[model samples]
Target: MNANKTLAIGCILGALAVMTGAFASHGLKAHLSSYALSIIHTGVQYQFWHALALVGLGSAMLRFPSRRLGRASLLMIIGTIFFSGSLYGLAITGMKWLGPVTPIGGVLLILGWFTAAWSFWRPDTDSVKA
Candidate 1:
């Protein structure tokens, strides 16, 4: 994905996370139990961090458009969807089936970070020196 596109998505996700957090705190406070609220909070926390990571990934891509970085960014997005998304679903609906999905997302996130590290470790032969 293009760096600009990745950055845009990251910004959007950050905005959504803030809105969701507000909604959870104000609107859902009365409806959900403390436990549920905590769960939702965890989801929001992970989402926010990952969103910020996306921004960093975008910046890295702008400086160095490595294929590994692109793949890592994609994996991060997927991780956010599955990890945070599953937590949100479970918190709101209390469904047990979504439990399994969280681990998958976590794995994706770990892999994404690993890929990013590998990308940095291996220098690009095509890059021109300033």
Candidate 2:
């Protein structure tokens, strides 16, 4: 992902995470069970954290520009969609099928972190000058 795109997406995700939290707490509290609310909260937390990570990745890319960082950004974006999206859908609709997708998203998130670590530890040839 390009630095600008990553940053934009991160900001959007962060905003959505906050909105989701507020919506769940205020709007859905009476409608949803405690367990459902817990699930939504978990998704909101993970999405918020990943969003911040993407913002950081975008800033780092502006300095160190690497293909690996781009890959990490893509993975994180997809992972957030899968993980948080599924949780929100599942909690709201009680969709059991989405449960399986949550783990796949978790795996993608883990991969994203590993890829980011690799980029910093063993950067590409076209990486930072200093």
Judged by lDDT, which candidate is best? 2
- lDDT of every model, 2 decimals: 0.88, 0.95
- Model 2 pairs whose backbones collide: none
Model 2 weakest 10-residue run by lDDT: 121-130
lDDT of 1 by residue, 58-108 (tens): 898899887788788899999999999999999999999998999999999
**What is candidate 1's CA lDDT for residue 125?**
40
Best by TM-score: 2
TM-score of each: 0.94, 0.96
lDDT by residue (21-125, candidate 2, tens digit) is: 999999999999999999999999999999999999999998889888989999999999999999999999998999999999999999999999999999865
